[model samples]
Target: MPRVEFGMKTESGEEFTINGELTDDELLTITNFVQSAEKLLECRLVQCGNFLPKKITWNQVSGFDICEVNEIDFEALFACLHLSRPFILQKEPWSYNSVSGILGRVFSHHSEVKRELKGLRKIYSDGALSYYFDISIQEKSIFDESRFLSWLNSYQYHRDQDKSVLYDELKSSFSENGAHHIMLIRLHGKLQAIEQLTHLCKVIIKSSAKQS
Candidate 1:
């Protein structure tokens, strides 16, 4: 087992680390959580974010360092796992007039997602921290600046490919911190690639405590 170390901090400012090989179950739990978050991104849940809760509840699960924190900024927690810290957590709201207005425009074609949500079903995560976070949503994303910026890079690319999409006019969604997103994406990719490889190979992940 390759040694993995996590730097954890509590809401009250206590910090500690859990460094070791993860049990099979702990690795599986974290894997599932991440998958869910990725699915949300693919589904374009970022457009439906206004309905997301401002605050979410969290409880530590089977593993990781024993940090007695209640309100770890969901974004920051995962940012560490990605090998960097996000300087900003709060994002600019989407420019649509209302949540539904954008959701309708965005998902009008994907009637299946709407119908299924009405029917009650849970999606899988590619990176959902739900195992540790009770509820991380579109409004309060689990992505650090790197991940979000990476998504935006894709979005802008696709938008340029197809300008006729109804929800393509979401420019107002960027916060003042948006300027640094592109820089983060380019540099962060170097850090993230090695992490995925760690799943299948004996890779030593590097860590730094620069982030919250």
Candidate 2:
């Protein structure tokens, strides 16, 4: 049987061995093993050596040996998510703590919304990066019709007469120490724009999860 050997380093700086066979079934098994270990140890496993899939011994197995694990820093990971690209594409680590916090705030009432708004303002005030969501659509519907018109009106009111108004609005809206806002703006003035927005958000979130 074709055999493979891979090396990885745990978050705690422990090196380990991972061996498997060069087959689809074996690859899936190896990935599952690594994921399980990551969950159990509460740490990420990074590949330490190139994937070598042609050299294996009968005694080798498709799993890690001497796996080392370490604690995770979720806060730092979350902060990093907003620093580089759109929120969805940012490579940030995800942990139960961070996920819980996000869910709590998102599902909270108006009071929580206000609190988050304030927090966003603070983030912007601290000169954090911001993202503007632009939408595009192939077809239109009632929702798109209404939201797009509203956004257009708002944009015109803020920018048509003077560009400075737009800048002023951005500054005012994103004010407060540590307050950062991800602005969702109508791009093609269509509700179908949501499709693109959704796609972008997914991409960012997925990337962040993997990297974190």
* Candidate with best TM-score: 1
lDDT of 1 by residue, 1-212 (tens): 23355554555887755344443444443444334334333332232322222333334553212222233233542333232221111231211112123223333544542452222211111122322443223444333333343444444323343332222222223322232232232223323332332332221123212111
Q: lDDT of candidate 1 vs native?
A: 0.31
lDDT of each: 0.31, 0.29
TM-score of 2: 0.15
Cα RMSD for candidate 2?
23.8
The runs of at least 3 residues in candidate 2 whose Cα sits more than 4 Å from the true structure, single-residue gaps closed, are 1-189
Q: Cα RMSD (Å) between model 1 and the true structure?
A: 19.4
Off by over 4 Å in 1: 24-29, 52-212
Of candidate 1, the 10-residue stretch with the lowest lDDT total is 87-96
What are the models' TM-scores? 0.22, 0.15
